[model samples]
Every structure is written in C-alpha cells, then in structure tokens.
Target: MTSFFATRLAVFSTLLLGGLSTAWLQAGENPDPLGEKTGGSTTVYASGKNAFSFPLASLEDEERTRFVIGNSFFKRNWVEAPASTTARDGLGPHFIARACASCHSLDGRGAPPDWSRTLGPEPDATVALLLRLSVPGKPAAHEGVVPEPNYGDQLNNAAIAGVKPEGRVEITSQSIHGRFADGTPYTLQQPHYRIVDLGYGPMAPDVMISPRIAPQLAGVGLLEAITEADIEGNARAQAAAAGPVKGQVNHVWDAFAKAERVGRFGWKANVASLAHQTAGAFNGDMGITSSLFPQEGCTAVQIDCLAAPSGCPAKGKTDKAGKAPEIDDDTFGQVVFYQAALAPVARRQAKDPQVLRGQALFAQAQCIACHRPSYVTGEGPFPSLTSSKLSRQRIWPYTDLLLHDMGPALADGRPDFQANGQQWKTPPLWGVGLIESVNGHQRLLHDGRANGVLEAILWHGGEAKPAQQKVLKMSLAERQALIKFVESL
Candidate 1:
C-alpha cells in the first residue's frame, strides 16, 4: 500500500481500537446490533456476486422451489412467436430485451451505456436503461401519462426478426466540475439523450422522455410490506415538522386491487403493487402479456406490431374463457414471489468506529430525513406468498417511500402520476455499498448518471440541497467516514 493508504489503514485501526470514547460512540445513536440484517429475518448473508440472487433466509423449504422456478423465468430468454417453445415465445414485435436479466443482471442494478463509446453512429443497444416517452396533456385520474401518439409509453430499441424496433436511444454527456470546502475537485457526467432511427415516424414536437435504469430487486417485498399508515405517517410528520423534505403519498391505480392505492414501487412511485410492477415489466420490457396486463404494448400506427402473433396457448389449450395470457397466473405469481422474497444482503463492518462516526455525519447532514432508517413490515401485498416471514419484523431499509422534489439537475421533465418533473420517490439505501461487488459497477440514480454514492449525494438538490451542501463542506476524513458509514449499510 502507498503511504497515504497505509496512513488511512492506521487511522482506521486506531478508531477501531477505541481511539473514540465509548460514551461518544453510544451518543451517536448506533443502530441495532442486528441492524446488519437489512431485511430482518429475510436478510441473506451473501456478499459475493450472487448476493442479490438469494431468497429470504426465513423462507420455508417448499418456498425454495418457487424461488428457483421464479429465477428460471426471470433469467429465461423469450423468442418470437410461432416458435416451438410456445411457453416462452412471443418476445416482441418491438421491445428492449428478451429477458428481465438482460438489464438487471444477477438481479442487481443496471449500468448505463458507456457515454464515450455511445457517441458513434452505431451506439450500443440499451437493455437496462429505457426511455419513457409521453406528450403534454391533461392526464386522466387513473392514467398517469398520455402516451406519445406514435410510440406508446416507452421507446423500444429492439424487436423480433420480422419487425423493426421503435427506435435507437443515443446518449452523450458533458463533465460537471466542482470542489469541496477543502478544495478537493470532483467531476460528474451529465448525460444528454436522443431517439434516432425512428422505425415509425417523427414523434410529437412536445414529446417528453425519461430515462430509467432497472433498480436492484432485493427486499422489494419487504418495502411493499411497510404499511400505508406508516408511510403516510412519515409524510404527516414531515409536514408537521415544516421541513423542506416534506414527502407525499402517490395514489395510483392498482390493476390487482382495481382501486387507487398508495404507490410503493418505481422511481416516481407510480406503481402501487409488485404484481402490477412485475406484469407491467413483462409487457413493457419483453412484450410478454400477463393476466394483469393482457394488451400488448403496441400502437395502432405500428402495423407490424399490431399484427404480431402472441405467445398465448394454442386454440385447443384455451381456458374456460376461451383465452389465456401469454404468462399464466401461476408463472406470474412465481416471478412476483421471487422478487418479493429476495433477501437484502447483510451489512458489513457496522460496528467499526470510522463507520459509526460516518453514520453520525450522515444524520448530522439530515440525510436521515428522507432516507428514514427502520420499519417493522406488515403482511405484504401477497399474504399467501409472503406469509408471516415479512410481518412485524424491523428492517433498516433507509428510505421514506415518498416523493420529494429532487430539483432540475436530476429532473427528467416528465410527470409520473402525482410526481411532478422534479419529484422522485426516495430510493432505499440498503445494499447500496455492494452495487460494485454484485454488478461490477457503481452506477447510481434513476438514469445511472452518478458513478457512486458521493456523486449521487453531490447531485442532490431541491429538498436535499441542504444535505448536499453539508456533504460539500465536510473535511476529507469526515467525508470518508460518512461514505464508509453509508457503504456499511
């Protein structure tokens, strides 16, 4: 190690050896010793590449079979319709990827295309990073957005053999530079996107596009298990406190419940349930239909897409209704179960003094306001599947599960349900540190613009501008400690 690294290691050792007083450590409000179990009993101990792939630790032996089956479907590739493999056929007339794992490799986060390499005429095809497109209009109460007259809600960059893709998504970026209070310079990549090679025609002049990177899937069920009352209470408390971090519940239409419910998933909290989220992904990402989303994601203008054969069962294999979704309820349920039951990997070195000090710095900076620490989950969305494992167990996910204005710097200028252009749902911080280990990349934010945690923090604005300012003013050691503390989560 270099002298600088050796010096850091020595100081870290000293801190671990009680260089900080016991009283001070206790005063900093260290989390529960078992807080390392990020998903409570559902937490997994894996820290390697396969960390995000494990099922809940508390799942019964029989449930493991379901998890295995779900993993298969999640990783399985779908072919175009009229193929021999009818079970997994009917991929897309126009779609982004053939399988869910294409973007969320290993069930972990997806990285954006390399901006430098993407500037060429033949840019890389974006599998994980998709563009959500819409036109300006008064959205119906149940509808969050008016789909662009041409390409529906999202821009698909790939298609089946006989059909042309909607278009290719191109990206380029400029470097943003800034410095800390100590004059330590930093650079951030600010991305610019374009939709080219339109398979159909030009989109509306006022079309809006939002770039979304597929987030990790671990502990999603646990997040769903957090009660509406608890989540709303967070919003109420923030309002009462009169803090700039006031969060609001996003009530969105639920396909499962057939009613408006509190949004719990998505970057904008537009999705209300995991079933809806899962089914929507099946339709939008791979063009595979489920009972929840029976219609294919095709526009009337796209004649090829409209005429494409579905992967539904043969005529003789029809149900009592004389029709069936491409993916039956059983298969869809298995995938949802797999997503809900994937355990958050256990934290590393939570008790280290440097980490604890950093934890204090994180709180002092008021990051805990939005990144709320703990919640005892309730019975999740699927009572039968989640069972008692996720019920009444305290988990430290570090998110408020509410929408806050993230400022223009991070805005996509697209409204999603109740979330305005600047508003974004607070993402959970559990397993954040392990993104590099699990996915071999540290891309963060909805569009994968930030390279790591610090960059993600620096990009913070709107309600979080104060918190960002606090971090900018931190001393080098203090910043390191704060980062170490967040990574330990």
Candidate 2:
C-alpha cells in the first residue's frame, strides 16, 4: 500500500484497536476490534422491534427535541390544498404514498407484498415500495434513463382527488430451487412486474422498470457523512483486484450541488446526498413539493394533474398565499435532521464463537471484495443533520458505496446514471439482521425476492459470482457460521 493508504490504515487501526480481539481468528483478524459497533460510540441499543427510529444517544437535548417534532411530519399524511390544514396541504398531482412513513414504515424497510396472503396497501399509497420507470436514451443523454414522456420517471399507482392516476403496478412470481453443498434445498422467488391501468396512455415502446423497496433509515446521516475520497478509493482498489469483483462509481444529479456527483444512496446509488434523497421523496413519493423540488410532479399529458393545487406563494409574500412549497424549508430540513440523527442498531452477538468463525469464513470467501466492512467518514458540510463525533469516525457499514455487476439473475436491465443494468451499489449490512424485527418480514435484495440472508447470498453473481461459488461449496456448518457472523452485525 502507498503512504496515503498506509496512513488511512494507520488511522483506522488506531481508532479500532481495543474493544475486542480477533488475534486468534485468521480470516476475521482486523486491528479494528470495534467493527461491529458500526457507529462507534454513537451506536444505540434498541431491540429489532424498536429499531430504525431511535435517536443517537449522544445528541444534545435540543437536537433530541427536534427529532420528535420531525417524526410527526414524517408520519402524518398530507392533505389536498384549499383545506384548513395549510401547513401540510397540497397532496399529489400524482404520488406514491400519503407520507414518508407509508413506504418507510416505522422508519424500517417496506415489506414485500405477500401474494399468498392479502395484497398489501395500494402500491402507490406509501406501502413502502415503488417502481422506477425510464426508457433507453442515447449516450449523449448522460442523465441516465429517460423518463416516459407522459408519465415521468416513476410509476405512480395512486393520485390525489380529481386527478387521474398514472397507472397500476401488478406483480407475479415463479420459484427457483437449488441445493447447498450438503444437499439442503432452498428456493428463491423471481418477481415479474406488469404495468396496467394506464390512465394517460401507453408507455414508450420499450419502457424499463426497476422496483425498489424502502430501506431502513438508521445511520443514513453517517452514510452521507462518508467522504468522496474513500468511496472513490474503494472503486480504484477493486478495479485493480485480480479477482472478478471490479466495481464502478455512479455519477448522479445532486440538486444541492446543482451538478453530478458521486452517488452514495439508493439501490443504484442514483442519489448523492440525504437531502437530495429526502427532497426527491417529498416530490416523487408524496407529491408534496419542497423548496428543493418546487414544481408539481405532473407530466405534460396529464392536464388534470397539472391543475392540482400547489401551495405556491403569490407574486409577493402574503398570509393568504400558502407556503410556496407544500412542505416548508424548515419542516423539510427537520425531516432530514430526523433521518440523519436516527441511530444504527448496536450490533448483537459479536462475541459468539460461531459468529466469529463465520466472520473469518466470510473474509475467506472474498465477500469483502465488494461488501467492504469498514470506513472512516471525512469531515463534511452536513450541519445540524450531522453529529460532530461522527466526523472522522471509523464506522463499519459493510459496503463500498460503489456499483458492482451482480450478473444476470439480479439485473434490473435499467440504466441509472453511470450504473448499468447489472451493477448495483453494495447494500450496507450493518443493520441487515434487524430488518425482520423492524418490518416483520425478512425479504432481501432490491425487490425483496431473496427470502433471507442466505438466499440473498445465494443470488449473488457477476463480480460476486466467485464469492457465491465459494459459499455454495462450504459445508453447511461453515455456511451457517458465515451467516451467523453477518447476523451478529
């Protein structure tokens, strides 16, 4: 390693040297013993059922109070304009849910609909998931997928009063069964999506769809706190690797930066900052405009949608003129703060022998090639949304925040900025074990197709194919050990 990387390791080693020891564990050996304490001293100890919405334990009293206030806006549904509720009025010309909490229930992942059981909430009604739409564009477009002209980038399954909804989302599935080295059979469900009930007209001849589930909201602020240098360095390191796991960076539009920047959030890393992601959700998911996204979400073809109430202020400010944006800047900022301040669940069972053995085996299997286990966030511009202690802190989020090709099985066939159909930003594993408790379901992967941790692992391909192969051959005991280590985190 060069001096620059050597210094990085030196700083990382210094920060993580003493909480525990992996000296006796080869594959698990790292000088950073506090790897499982993902947020370092800032980790929170909420149970899985209570996970995802807790504030950082170190926050000042004032910041803690702000978190509570933000929680109300996040959960409460917004209403249509011309109503008594002026502060939160102006619902969709077209939208996916009533509130942020609709998709991110309890600040946790959205559970995949159980086809065998009842159909969950209306797909567009903030049910914790939605489908992204785009048509292939020329290389010169450079902005990733082209939005379907009349419908825009996302398929909205619901609309506000007096406006025609964009379309409906329908899903069907088929199962694929495979066996482990020890002959234990496992089955994986493959989802197929169809867009029906087109309110406007037909989609482009070749519209591409990418379905995404709402992710758990813990530690997102810290994820945004991660520096560009570290993410780029990981990309460079992986490109130079002798293995199959070379990953690429996604350059996405950052509304705040007013330019394309390194993406670090979303399934395809299509978003650069938490603020951008939050504002985009306010507009696209809930049809509630914020200063960041000032216009209604209506497409040109939907005349009625364009006529929906917007809270834009009159030419000059006045009490009669409602908040220009349905959600005022102060409220939006507070929501961002709440999201940022939410603490990552403190790791569980890191000291177990099985988990440690699994940790070692995980390394041996080369899973770390893409699912990078640790990072040191750089000093950043994030203010109230960031904690001072989080600056330069060594964190173990278990992701590289770069896109890796996962082969064909998991490909969405959708281009997102610099990310191709087969590439995906390695999803973080820090809170992987708590999803079941938080959402009451254990669906994994971008579409909630993989049933659990192990199934998710089995579906890996492309750069992760070799890693998956290694996992496929491991003894059932060894595999369980590896999975146990992941669950412990």
Among all windows of 10 consecutive residues in model 2, the one with the lowest summed lDDT is 15-24
| Clash statistics: count for each candidate | 0, 5
- Each model's lDDT comes to 0.82, 0.78
Write one digit per residue (lDDT tens) for candidate 1, span 308-368.
8888563343657666678878878888888888888889987677876786677678887
Inter-residue clash pairs, candidate 2: 96-124, 97-126, 102-126, 103-128, 358-481
Model 2 vs truth, CA RMSD: 5.8
Candidate 2 per-residue lDDT over residues 381-429, each given as its tens digit: 5676454646765678888899999999999999988899999889998
- Looking at candidate 1, what is the lDDT of residue 377? 74
Off by over 4 Å in 2: 1-34, 116-126, 139-142, 312-323, 385-387
All candidates: TM-score: 0.91, 0.90
Candidate topping lDDT: 1
Runs of candidate 1 exceeding 4 Å displacement: 1-34, 117-127, 314-323
